[model samples]
Target: MFTNIRKFSAVVVTSGAALALLSACGGTDSASMGGHDMSTMSSSAPAATAASAQPSATFNDADVMFAQMMIPHHQQAVEMAELADTRASDKEIKDLAAKIKAAQDPEIQTMQGWLTAWGKPMPSGGTDHGMGHDMLGMMSEEDMKKLADAKGAAFDKQFAQLMIAHHNGAIEMARTEQSQGSNPEAKDLAKTIEAAQQAEVEQMRKILKRL
Candidate 1:
């Protein structure tokens, strides 16, 4: 009878261990299911983000050229605007100069950021990235020098004339970007430039008539 009791105890212990092992395996399987679901969600999120980012990330040669060419164009305009602080005779001209400087300065930084992102070089030196005379409405060295020499009323008139041409050139370049560039942000910037500069050109023309 004691031998039978010992055998029964051994059987009970074995059955209990088997139940515990089974329970552990079930818990592990449940945890694995939850983990797989989370992993799937995490993986899909990046794919969605990449898809959304694709348009802005993609750019073409025109977009590159637009930014490259415009940075110097804007720099020159800002220089011209700076001259108005001391050189311009009219309050209108001074106000306009301030406006131009404010608008174009941020634009310059923004384009620089783009070039950096694209691994493209900034236009070297004071010139328009070798576009030179071919770059429409860019002031000649002589033209800038002459403007610098002038003071008061003469400076205001010259500033208006030169800036009208400058604005026209920027508008053309912006239109080109709109038509040919692939990047959404660049094209949008181009459009903003075109609209804003066109309005400024009109305002300058009116100012010219008054002068």
Candidate 2:
């Protein structure tokens, strides 16, 4: 009977040890699975953040065309404004030209930036891409030459007249942009251009009367 009890006790102890070992293995497996889950969550978070951080390329074709066409348009205006510094006799004309140059130079750079961001081509070398005189208010090469040759009162009158026409053309373009453009920034700029150029046009008309 004593020998039977010793054998039974050994069997019970061995079974208990096996159960303990199994419990430890189960705990290790649960910890490993939890670690894997945590790692997956951490990795996915950065990927989500990266996706959200990327710039929204929400621009449409109208935005592209507006930027492309306006760059050259602004460039020509700046050129005309530059001529006023040397050729214009009226103090008002000179001041107006300076203002035009200052406003348009920055605008040209801004439009260029938009084109670059959109992966669209810029107007080459400040030249309209065959758009030429067909573009509203664009002076022909001949017109530009005449302005370049004139001085004093002739320069001031011609400059004011040409600039007035140019501003009208710009206002028309801005109106089109406001109607058609999808990008918020581009539409906002179009509105600004329309209002500002309209005011300038009125001012120029007043100046024309004086001249």
Candidate 3:
């Protein structure tokens, strides 16, 4: 699934957009929170406007963490996909890899843009993925090297298995964001990631079965 970008400002802006979008959809029964009438709250807008507050402009700590962690996670996936171009022999595997790369590369940029717009520093420094091996289904450097060195049927099989595992990790993280996140855009993105990765996971399993 393709993701839409939002101008997700910090916490304050997110709250405002929630208010505006809700109001736009139809008035709320109680336009207030914690004794404050959000309808009359009259707070100044964040640095961004509603037009810009897309893909994500309002976010909470959960959204921030989701973006921060997922950035590197998606990056690693892109790296693995790049390797598939040469290493994979099966046409379906190659096409899937290409699709994964196309989908995730822009998502990396979108998340990074959210972090930057929110005034958070993107994880600094090199090719280091900065995620645990089991924490988010990341493969070790050794494993990546192994995949890179492989070709033909061996490469396709290993890639499908590893990518399935990797997609599962991403789906897990995305589910967390959906439940715990405040930014509408971020939550929607999480849903997109979850659905897309789940579909791909099943696809990969079918490919593996054939191999």
Write candidate 2's Cα lDDT for 61-123 as tens digits: 556656656666677788889999999999999988888787777676666777777777765
Task: Return the top candidate by TM-score.
Answer: 3
lDDT of 3 by residue, 16-83 (tens): 45645665677543132221111100001111122122355556666776776676667778888999
Write down the lDDT of every candidate, Cα atoms only.
Answer: 0.64, 0.61, 0.65
Regarding lDDT, does 1 or 2 come out ahead? Answer: 1
Error of model 1, residue 26, in angstroms: 61
Q: C-alpha displacement of 211 in model 3, angstroms? A: 0.9
Off by over 4 Å in 3: 1-57, 127-131
Greater TM-score among 2 and 3 belongs to: 3
Measured over all alpha carbons after superposition, the RMSD of each candidate to the real structure, in angstroms, is 28.3, 30.6, 12.1
Report the CA-based lDDT of candidate 3 relative to the real structure.
0.65
The number of residue pairs in model 1 that clash at the backbone is: 0
Query: Which has the higher TM-score value, candidate number 1 or candidate number 2?
Result: 1
